[model samples]
Target: MINFINKFKGKSSMILRKSKPYRYLICILVFMTTYALLAMGLLPEKYSLEVAQVSPATIYAPRTVVDPYLTKLAEDEAVAAVPEVYNLEASITVAALSGLNQTYASLEEAAIEEDPQEQELLLQAIKENLSEEIEISHVRKFINLTSEQREYIYTNTYEILERNLSQGIKIESIDRAKNQVINELTLLTTDRDIRDLLIDINVPLVRANLLYSAEATERDRRQALNEVTEVKILKDTKIIDQGEVVTELHIRQLEALGLQETSSQDFGYYLGLALLIGIVFIIIGVYLNIYNQSILVDSHKLLLLGIIFCLTLLLSKAFSYFSAYLIPITLAPLLITILFDRNIALLLTIPLAIFSGIIVGNEFTYIILALTSGTVAVFSVRKVNQRSDLTRAGVIIAAANGLTLIALSLLTGSFQGATDFIKNISLDIIMGMVAALLSSILTIGILPFLESAFGVTTSIRLLELANPNNGALKRLLIETPGTYHHSIIVGNLAEAAAEEVGADPILARVGAYYHDIGKVSEPYYFIENQLGNENIHDSMKPLESSKIITNHAKEGVSIASKFGLPPVIIDLIQQHHGTTKIAYFYHKAKEQGEGEINESDFRYPGPKPQTKEAAIIMLADSVEAAVRSLKQPTKDKINDIISTIIEDKIQDGQLDQCDLTLADIKKIKEKFAKVLLGIFHQRIQYPQK
Candidate 1:
């Protein structure tokens, strides 16, 4: 069981370490967690409810907020207030007039005809057309009427019907039009049959003419509702009273306030959050690929960067739970600046600030604050010479945070009066300062662990290693004191050159200090550690002496790794000599007329300087040794020797693998001359003291 568990653990570790997908999964998981947390209180909730439920308690706006629920409700109310629409048809009046005129013509034709039965039949047909219940006796009296009586009834009935039904007729008001027509016809004639004919024919025919338009009514209501804008509930506004019955409005308010816990309609909200997270990650990925591809491809760098970003975000989010001002926005940027370069730190800071602004709910203000503080943090320790520089950077960042808070306070009108301004601003200032100071303190505390765990070589770590008490350097000093002294001068020259070329001088100095640790293994075998006239190499063969010399680069790397030094320093130890041949021993072997010696055996095993620091150290090692060989060296001799060594290295392709350019080499040469001139400056022969 124990073996099985160990095997399973080993397999899991291998899968996690070797698979890009697993690392990506971890990265996306962290991103999604942050996105979910940010979206929790920021979006509105969807509630499951109906009308008239008892509200559990009073609710107020948690922050400055927009109530989309209230907005929709206002739109609905506006729609309800709109009056119903109807359609008027003028054809109804025209049809009624035509029917009355036809009746009158039938009555006139019946009065002139000798056939009274036909006339009565026509008038009866007209009466039936008006209404099936019209009396037959009334039809007979209408047929017997004179033309004048018929014309009067026709004109009067047609006129009344036109006046009433032509413009519009509501379905509910149909009877009023019928009544008006009846009253108008009654006054027009005293004859009972004439009155009955007009009333019976026209009154029944006076039906509701206007059509109810449901589609048109809805359209009009919608148009009116559209005029109303969305309603927003302000921060701290009271939404309900305790024990108040929950109306639909109350439910809407609760949803708008994001207080309803169970919302089924949050897919869009979560999707938007996902999109935001994806965009931020893509931007960070593209930038790293373009400017720092090594970090993007290497799992250690990628995971370490993600860890720092997430830690900073989580801490900021935690602080925001208490107050947004307590967000230590500078921490990630400062930490990156110390561990990595300022460019990577600066590049990542922008996205960090954007995420902070989104998380805190006031993007403009929070963005400004984060950017100002993060930028200060970047510049503060960009080229940290010692640990104290980190402290100084923290103070500067804190001061910048205070100033930014002051500006924001004044701009936002966050004060009722001068005293209020002072009190509030002071509190905010303290929060900002404490956040920056805490970030600085935390960064310093965690920096060593990060450097060790990630295999990163920061200047602070280099400085720590450069201390005299370091085990390897101490061993070199005690076992090979001459080599240690030689290393110190080489370090000084390399540091000056690195500084002139805008490279890391601290890295150069630290690398130079430990570059000769291999000499400690066999101290007396090398010239620098020899004390008496007899040299150990004089008794040895050229091949043996050359082998000892060649083996030191490999031995130095071994010693550096044993000391737990960074890979960068080990790289310096391994590559400082590059593949340069030990010329004296090689020539001596050739002059001895030994069978053709293989050139490869005399050369140092090397991956020639892989960085500017290592390359600079390589040059310094050779220049310091070459200058030391000159008896009573003058300033001119030191200058010429330094220039020749640099040129020779360039021609030998020693700097080809590193990033050093022609311009950087020129600056390095000038810096060497300046430093070497000081070391070999002409002394004045003053009067004997």
Candidate 2:
């Protein structure tokens, strides 16, 4: 088994390097496509029905929406609960007081008449002008009293009317208010006639003082209506049972959601959904631009991301057609974590979860399931070693999904009877486990295709390539033992240096193991694989010798590619020697040739090391070869050779294209010296027994 040593250092193939505008355009297209899919998927299936029509199928509310008709009913009930409001008419009281004062003046004037007959006639006329409650006898007796007494009666009556009438009195309370006025007048005087006259006068004035105020009444009703909450039709709630007669209420409910045949689509609903989806896309784009600019600028990665998103969405929606719990929500995170880093995978899981939840009829249950399952899958595959590790991750995801379902069931109280509860719980656990397992299975199955399509070297691929039993490594061991031994030592040295500099140690180590794989093709032609005291170069021309040595880098790339090694490993094999010249052959040619010898002919064809790991392998390979050629490589000699080899590469401009800093190169030198000291350390000779 291969030892998996480091975090993944896969490089996605750059299909196209996009300019700024094209990058933005690609993002916009992805966002628009995703939004369009979500919008179309979320729309509920419409039904054609009328009042009294039998429903063909049982319909559940696609999304949680406010039932406009039901909400109006609730508002109406709330308004009914509020009492009617009325206002007191101050003008009525004023009119009553003025009428009383005029009547008192008329009675006083009639009392001033000389003839008793004339005064009686005047009292009769005054009686006719009074309210029906006031009899002619009561008026005549009131005129018989002295003017002072009449004025006193007037003053007490005026006070009684003013006080009682000012307070609001609806039509229902008018009788009680009149009785209150009668009691007050009865308490005013001992004389029956005077009491009778005051009772009749003030009681009549106490007409209904309260008036119905439409504005005030309507204001109170509307306030009560405002306080009533909207009656929402929750998601998954059954709108109509199969074969049940459709009522006006059902029709209205369907109309509110635009599910009715005759109902027009609500543009506001689509607009709002579009805006929300657009915002999420903008946030993700901003995050990528700020943090993952490499992916942002590369159209291939962007296209890959878009394809993954669409595939996950398509599957989620398709699976949701059966049961929401069966949707493989973890697929996105698993694929993303393999293709990219975990941070991006983790961040993007949120939107995928939410969108899947929406696709499955807007259930929060699926949303929670997706989020938890995806998160667990990401953490589980953080350091996968082989393909089987993905299956193990599947089991881990399954366990997490099962536990999450149980917790959700407990929170939602979805279980019913004891028997039903156990059955439902078991089904939930099984479905969640299946979905999670499906995510892993799909990830494992799709990874190879994505790897090939995108030219990405994932951690799983690296671990497989690193195995000693692999075909390429095995061929090197069997055919070119010396080269294989040299490769192993170079691997150890490069791995240590890569670790010290925070480069990908696994990439460097594995690359070193296969750097000289081309030697297997013509094993004895190279010095490492030649027999003792046998040199093929002894008989060969210097120019031909230089060609063989330099051609190995190219040959190694072809071999690695033929073995299906990742492009990263192929690059390492090709760039390990860079363009450094075969100094011995080049100098020999200079000495032997009668004409000028070109330096370019002696150098290896190379694009140079483009990454930190490739650079470390290049340096380690040179250091190992030079140190091995020395006789009695003491610690001082090894250290000097390591420094000289690295310094020569630097001076030759071989390290200029890579991103290694001076400090990093210093650390690499120290690390190489320390590791080489151990490899070439002096050994004590055991005495022969």
Best model number under TM-score: 2
Residue-wise lDDT of candidate 1 within 363-460, one digit each (tens)? 57879899889999999886786777778888998899999998998899888888998887898889888888888888888888898877898877
TM-score of 1: 0.75
- State in Å the error of residue 508, model 2: 1.4
C-alpha lDDT of residue 284 in model 1 = 76
What lDDT tens digits, residue by residue, belong to model 2 across residues 1-689? 12122112222223244556666677787777777767875566788999998999998887778998999899888988988778888888888888878877888889788898888888888878766766787777777887777777778878888888888778999999999889888887787866777776667778887988888889998889889999999877898999999999999988887888787775766887788888888888899989998887777678788878888988987898788888888888998998898998998899999888877767888898899998998999987768888899899999999999989988888887688678878987898899888988999999989888777888787877878899999999999999999999999999999999989887888999999998888888888888888799989888898888888888898898778888789989888888888899988888887488889988988878888888998899889999999888898899889889899999998998899999999999999999988888888999999
Tell how far residue 655 is off in model 2, in angstroms: 3.0
Worst 10 residues of 1 by lDDT: 42-51
Which lDDT values do the candidates have, in the order given? 0.81, 0.85
- Residue 329 Cα positional deviation in candidate 2, in Å, after optimal superposition: 2.3
Candidate 2 displacement at residue 140 in angstroms: 18
Model 2: what TM-score? Answer: 0.77
